[model samples]
Target: MLLPNSKRILLKLSGEVLMGEQQFGINQETVAELAREVKAAKDTGLEICLVIGGGNIFRGMAGAAKGMDRAQADYMGMLATVMNALAMQNALENLGVHTRVQSAIQMDAVCEPVIRRRAERHMEKGRIVIFAAGVGAPYFTTDSGAALRAAEMQCGALLKGTSVDGVYDSDPKKNPDAKRFDTVTYDKVLADNLKVMDASAVALCRDNEIPIVVFSIREKGNLARVLAGEGVQTIVQGNK
Candidate 1:
């Protein structure tokens, strides 16, 4: 189902998607294409907020597993997200789309601090706001940061653009017969460990009454199509 009058929405992207077909790191060509897709959505008169993950460059949990200090590793991961936000900002600006990178971690030389009112003003002036650094804290994932920003911004919905077309009962990659859901309850996602997102992120959206729309970002023009309610996607909401 289409979101009810989605004037403003949060678009959450995984950093791995920026890697394109490569094994690691940001791929410039891929970022440009994604920027075009975002611009198209913005041109549709929708205000956009973006939150990108840092797994493409570094994953804090992976570092912690390898014996690095969890907090320090997480900080490194946060910086990686800033790099991504800057790349996206550059790409969008090249396309003549006004964009701002508001980071949770203070970095005045590169981007603005995460000020809710300022971000709201930026959106009002037609600039896309990209939030970085995952709530500026260790332990919390970008998914959690996205949920927080979605709530703070009072976004109509949270659009999770991933490589997969939608949420499935199991890992579609591992299980060829995995069943995809057109609609799902937040509780079911949590109870089933569906992995639509982390448990905390799902709970935040559920508590705030924000719908989460999951769709494939790899598909060309899919973001716009999903926003139009004409693309393959899974909507996660509270039980009716």
Candidate 2:
């Protein structure tokens, strides 16, 4: 997929990917590999920000379903994301890639608070900033947080790194004949409920004119390839 000219991007990764082959929790080796891929992309001179989900550890909706207070459950979910961010930060730093973890829910002792200007400056100095805590509020997913940060940072594109290669017409896991789309319109995604992202996230990207590129981050060296416009990915854009 040929993406638009994106000098800066916000990459959203699901917490499940950190599980690797495990049923739950983070796999250090896998995270190390992902960090390398991200480093490669950064080496290409593209500024990057990251937002990671907390599904592997906890899901707010699931907690709510179990009769927990919605807001409290969501807060736990947000903390899970912060943990993931810390793990990612460790991996990236171990690879000798300078990184910073910025949280929407401030824990100044652990990470810096969300400050757009500081984050921009970090990127300018070649440091990757990881945003955590999912918009710092309840009733929102990390997907929405990614979209919001992408818009706030004026990222050229929003990269969704998942286990799936691209966006499929149906649940590819269940439907063997499911077709993957190389290019899809944001409206089509929203209208069809493609599950590429939450409707709010998709709408935010659409409204901001930022493309969403969905690709498999599990694949070795794929992040760089996708950023270079030569990898398998689904590009979601305005009426594409």
Candidate 3:
């Protein structure tokens, strides 16, 4: 069962997850499975908001590093995220889960612009709101956008669904002996450069006293398992 204070959560998913086994672009079957998981979580009566990254399509920093204009690359990256948000929206709706896509960089024809009160109303009506376009600015990541929306929506927790199960002392893929943390302080995560999230995202959650739950999304049924506090995960919170 979730703590009494954790009725609402903001979920952040990397775009790569949408690719599934493919090297690039959205994989329909994978997204359907993810949508089912999300619907299952919502069925537990939790208000959910989502932020999806665009790394599978394009990354502003990667483009900038390859000689493109940084701001232009970032705008392109933002567009990529919008595409991903639409894809997820379709998948969720196919599962009979109502969802709304609100873009920071609004294209009114496709989706609504980010309006805090409107978003809250949507969730109140049992509709999930997916935030797209990171911060509406260059040099910012979707992680920061997720944190910002999580704060704006006053979500009790930010659930980061990644490939790894939890935050580790080192890169678990490279260091087979790396230790996973069951719980860790915000300061320790930042000081150790744990890579659980960008520094800004972590700091924002820390400042707001919102706990960040890190867990693997690829595993079947893990989202609900973690939400029920019965799965392997790392909880990042303030020092007691």
Q: What TM-score does each of the candidates earn?
A: 0.99, 0.97, 0.98
Model 2 agreement with the true structure over 1-240: per-residue lDDT tens digits:
245577889999999999999999989999888888888888888899999999999999999999999999999999999999999999999989999999999899999999999999999999999999999999999999999999999999999999999999999999999999999999999989999999999999999999999999998988888887889999999862
* Better-scoring candidate (lDDT), 2 or 3: 3
- Clashing residue pairs in candidate 3 are none
For model 2, where is the 10-residue window of minimal lDDT? 1-10
Better of 1 and 3 by lDDT: 1
Tens-place lDDT per residue, model 3, 117-163, is: 99999999999999999899998899999999999999999999999
Q: Which ten residues in a row have the lowest lDDT in candidate 3?
A: 1-10
- The residue ranges of model 2 lying beyond 4 angstroms of the native Cα positions read none
lDDT at position 84, candidate 1: 97
Task: Name the best candidate (by lDDT).
Answer: 1
Model 3, residue 26: displacement in angstroms? Answer: 0.3
Instruction: Flag regions of model 1 displaced more than 4 Å.
Output: none
lDDT of every model, 2 decimals: 0.96, 0.94, 0.94
Sort by lDDT, best first.
1, 3, 2
Error of 2 at 170 (Å): 0.9
Pairs of residues clashing in candidate 2: none
